[model samples]
Target: MSESVIPRPSGAQQGRRFSLGPALLFCPGSRPDRFSKAAERSDAVIVDLEDAVVPGEKEQARQNVVQALNWEEPGLDPATTLVRVNTASSGELDADLDALAGTELGHLVVPKCESVEELDALAERLPGVGIIPQIETPRGVLEAERLAHHEAVVALFWGTEDLIAGLGGVTARRPNGTPRGVIGHIRHTVLLTAAACGIPAIDTICGALADSQRLAVESEDAAAEGFIAKACVHPNQVATVRRAYTPEDADVEWAKALIAAFEQEAGLAMDEGRHAEPTVVGAFSFRDEMIDAPVVLQAQRVLSRYDATRQR
Candidate 1:
């Protein structure tokens, strides 16, 4: 089946704002049926063809993605589909993009992105395609600000495992306990870049699937640190990722209250009904900054997704 490109934003609003999804889809090759199940559960589907695909099976892996994209389903939205193409400088990168271009994938994630020249190559090759540049090396982290500003880049990703490996284990510990110390540093870099460019900063996957409790803790830590979403390797990890990325009910309520109070106060007011004293500037500082916007909106989005999935 021929591939199809995802829907692009209107020209008027192009490059001005990015709509970040709730989760980063991590597709590690398993079986076709396994992919189907994972796709259903994942908020975004990333058809990976890099590290996850064995060298000999790269072609077969490409074919699998092609076939899967053509398969009929209850009805899948192409907007949520992403294909993780090999890095632009890699030998297989061209073939990867050629095979999947024009398809219904929302973005092409370039692995090991370290320079603007590589991004320029990717942009030339895949015009109109969104890019998710994975910062998996020391160079990539250092070049993050430039990459974030790249014309095709819509988001930034931190690859913890590969990055630590690239750093020659300088900050890497046993690799079993927690990647937090290492990831924390890179995440801050990526987060700052994303914030400066107004793009989404995605957190790397916490590879502790066996222990759901631990996964939950790390996932929450990433979210609290300002990562918009996280990637997941296992189906069981999806719920944890979603929960971590979403705001709690209490947080949502507080946000709603802030919005209401701010609306009623018009930035400043004397709450005679609640208190005799006047509520002056900085009293509703949180609302002024729109920090609570995500909390309220994310809670609503999560509940809506639950309802939609339940109905299906």
Candidate 2:
């Protein structure tokens, strides 16, 4: 959890395209009835085999997930499928993997990933599957960069609820609902580490399921802070998450204009209304903001993402 304790990430592995979806919904693996509906509603349906399932229902939940995979629902697609398995510490982890063995699962979400040894073993076991290790422990935070560079890890999701519990805290948020100090800091650590390792960083799920306005604020914060996606606990959160991930129409237009301006000329003086000290790149004025290299690159990604979503 200490900034000084962070380690450097290592290398890449057998890669698969990790979708830049906005909402990664966790449909309880025990509820097969909700599986196809959640898949259709969410950008990625993360069939959860942990937390939501009781111990007595664990095996049944595993079987349900496996059976749901074979479901011929119109919205079911392997590319949007992510299976959140039990942690290595859990006695049920092996069983979870066994349930999906030899199946072409697009992604595996391994929860409570605190040990690199467990990651290495999972990588070996699920060779071609894109792995997303959820970071929720103190050990996981310190070794995040190391985990990010793991050959199997495609993205990292910061599980704030478990993280707060692990840290012996009550909540990951303030009374007004913004992320608390330590949790917010750790969230940033996970974000930066994932970015440095060239992988997507998923923000923690918003706990206020009924508060759509608050969810929008939190999702906006996540997207503005460079998170590729937000986790969803319910179907209602999906639309807001997607909206947050996708650039607003005005933002998209601004990004397009900025990109066009950059393509036209490389000058440090194109301000009409916008003002900046000028960071020595193209200084096109855009709503009173500087148009530097980073800004330009951000615009490019925004438009690129918009195009990608439209195609999908």
Candidate 3:
């Protein structure tokens, strides 16, 4: 199949706002038959036009994405469906953009994103689409903060294998599956950069498809480190990722009790003529632990996540 010659949409909106759920699954773009199934099994589905498809099949894959994501009656929800396009330097992005020209798909995962200029070009070609820049190389890591601050960037994601290979390392993790020092630093760098930019950060995939235990542990660690979601290569990993991100019953109860206690304390202080903001005024003891501003915020976040999980 030849690349589609669709005309690029004009006057594309910039800096589109979008949200993603806790677990995202990547399905090869060439596999149109699995598109609906993947979307059903995951919080979001990424139709990959990059690494997953071979060179000869790229055109066919693009055609599949175009057909599957048709605007009038898309096989997948454009809001939650993401297409992973080829890197800016790969010379395939133009065809990828051409294929996606008129589709209602609103999100694209730009692999190996390393600079603001690259993002600027994408914005010019496909304005308003939420771009998730995948940081996997040394330059990408160094430029992460700048990339996160770009007006077109909606989220940041970090990859481990590519980064390790770029650095000429043998492995990104230790024997126990924990990230090595370098990989750990990069992970935190991406997380902190995204947090600073007020955007969500997605953790990389766990390639060991058969090891659900390891996937669970890694997903938990990613959630604890403040990642909004984890990317998975297989459908079976979706439940594990979602469970890891969801707040436990004990945690939900603690958050509720803490908020109630704080509200009561605030109400009493108001009656006594003391200023009570919905936040910590000073150091206070709750459940034998010192509850301060940060602790209160943590509790609030837990409740917020709990509520979101319930809604989903």
Candidate 4:
């Protein structure tokens, strides 16, 4: 993507909170058994409708997803099962919404979300489904704030390929191997928009399914840039995505110390090595803004999970 093509927000603002698991399992309808098994191990399961199902077999994929939702899989929370529907204007949109309407599934992942109006229409149809809108075009990125704030919208995921193509971005690889120009700008815009709206920000699917090393790097890169979770094209990418989202030991320790420090003095003294200035802790540095929320919570979340696991 090119810098000129990707539009930036007019003013400086805070970022958003992203909720991602170690891995989100994706089933595109090609491999049912693989998809089912992946769902068992994945942090969340996403049944895909776009880019996965053949044109002629789209209905079959929809039926498959609905059937899967009706199945009672042990240990699988229906709330964590997300259906990735086709674009709001696609032929399959109504069918997708109909299938999702009465189900126990809590999330609907809608692609090519170009405006809040589209969301309004979908929300009218579904009434109460949590919308995870995929911003995959220039118009979509520009309207991100509105989409993010839409009552139906709970999260926004960036789609690199579609947005890049929309912006006429070159496919050529940079010297470091990452795409240069327009494509990178689209990503930056997606991050900025999601941050401004205070919703979860997710990264697009990594195109390189065979290169595990590259996949790991890409996942980590998204994490560093404030993307909480990433879309997976294959089960192989789930573990990599999960590990990328997890906090390291150092992070967990820091979060624990911060929480402990604040609890001890009601926000007075942090650990000697960690706190250069006692006053910083007194101000409650960690809780002031959205940009810092993810880092702080990630650490806290890790420790909590560890504690919970140990008890069981």
Candidate 5:
């Protein structure tokens, strides 16, 4: 997609910032009773109004969400609570928006998002709401860059099962449970596109509820690849996702030591009356590895993740 096709946020929109914690748990909108529990269990709760609810229950689901928003006690936090609306083509988005209008909810997860025009229309109806576009189809993956740049988009999430289903594939994973090659490609494409647009990317949910070990491995891979968060289908998966995203104790110490060493080296350079370049001026050895600007930046990222997890 060309840069011109991507619309920039307005000045007011540009000033707004949205972020979610590392673990986001999904709760069916039809099951309002579980909303509070889901919120308590995960860092953020996504009340799913789309696939989670059958067509017959969609209206009831919408009403349930509205009722939950109106509750005085144990109300959903506008910051951490998100609603996953149906696709624009589903014929239910209009009703979804109508139900959500004038509510305190400020965030939405738009499923099957494949175009900027769709987002533009949604933003027009619900002004000031942040959107996390869920890319699942081939067109969505190809147009991810354009979708990521939309002003309403606060983050990007890709769905593996839907993508595979859309492509007429039998499964997204191999018999051994590792993701198929196409799934990996789509995941990386969405991740890189979101990163390029300076927004967070939410990893797909782990459907295998009983396979905690696989979920941990996948969550670790997502974190290693720079995904800010992972979506969970069940409450039990939340802690595993959080643990994978959080930096290890050894990693935190190593990052701190590396940063200190770089600062010391830079100090010595300045004391010698040498000017430091925008990047690191020279390379040095750290823990038997050649340390450079990139290495220092990686260390800084580790510390940043560590700090974010601590604050959460």
Candidate 6:
């Protein structure tokens, strides 16, 4: 399978290798038959060993996952091929790590993480691979900043389903179906914590897989909320997530125009031979919006991603 690059969110560095890509498709550890097809649809493929398998099938599923990971992948970037292992505290984790030891698995989706010690242990065990800890429990949500900054963690994932289940309650939803109240609060906390720690935040899976419109709305909402990517249980969810995350053609054009205006303004300032303080006039504007540090970075990222996609 050939690789498809999903650009990281606005403000991320260009060509960063370990980006948390938009929309990862999950393949059950027991269902290797779906692995190839799932990879074809999503930005990345996650062969799941945790929630997807029961105790009786766990050992076989682990072996199947290992085989699939080691198999030839012509189109999938090694970094894009991930595995979601059993939790750190699960006794199965040691075996899972050992099973994946010699392969070129680039990332892992860690579930139900609530402690920095778990991340520390994972760091010691899996030396080089990227780890995206799934913050599901209240404890995990509260300790998100620590999890985000863990030496081994590449990104933080806010798992909505697990979170609600952990809380033993329901997350109220607005009439529009977006998460509301406590659910929204926890999501924002995870997002803000990741931002504070300078890591990407991946939004949890949208359960309404059959409803493309809802998925789009939710994906857009997640991106607006500062998540770099989202998890998808089914392959069909990939396109909607990609569309939501990809900078729109108009937005990309606007970003380019904004950057051009800034550059032109800087040139005019220098040509006018007017030396002013760094804070003079505050900044430049594209249309009515002020082009501040974040805006400028976002414009650059938009253009960068657009250009990369075009080149590919």
**Backbone clash tally (model 6):** 3
TM-score of each: 0.77, 0.84, 0.86, 0.78, 0.86, 0.84
Against the reference, the lDDT scores of all candidates come to: 0.67, 0.78, 0.84, 0.67, 0.84, 0.74
At residue 166, give the lDDT of candidate 6.
Answer: 77
Q: Taking the tens digit of each residue's C-alpha lDDT, what string does model 1 give over 225-249?
A: 7676788877788888777766566
**What TM-score, to 2 decimals, does candidate 5 have?**
0.86
Per-residue lDDT of candidate 6, residues 1-312 (tens digit) = 999976433212321345546777888888777877887777788888898888788898888777776764323346678888997556788999888886778887788888888877776777677788888888898888777767677777877777777788765466777786789898888888877777778888888767788898888987666677788998878878877777888988787676666666655442221222223234776798776656666776676556545542
Tens digits of lDDT, candidate 3, 1-312:
999885533211222234476899999998888888899899899899999999999999998888888743337788889999997577899999987878888888999899899888888888778788999999999999899888778888989999999999999989977789999899999999988887888999999888899999999998888898899999999999999988999998898787777777665532231223445466678899988777777777687678768877
**Regions more than 4 Å wrong, model 3:** 1-18, 71-74, 265-285
- Which of candidates 2 and 5 reaches a greater TM-score? 5
RMSD of each: 6.9, 7.8, 6.8, 9.3, 6.0, 6.7
Model 5 alpha-carbon drift over 4 Å, by segment: 1-18, 71-74, 263-290
What clash pairs does model 5 have? none
Per-residue accuracy of model 2 over 59-82 as CA lDDT, tens digit each? 988878776676643234667889
The candidate with the higher lDDT, 1 or 2, is 2
The list of candidate 2 runs beyond 4 A from truth reads 1-16, 71-75, 265-292, 308-312
Q: Residues 165-249, candidate 5, lDDT per residue (tens digit)?
A: 9999989999989999999999999988887788878899989999999999999998898888899999999989989988889
- Provide the lDDT at 122 for model 4: 81
What number of backbone clashes does candidate 3 have, counting pairs of residues 3 or more apart or in separate chains? 0
Judging by TM-score, tell me the better candidate of 4 and 5. 5
> Whole-model lDDT, candidate 6?
0.74
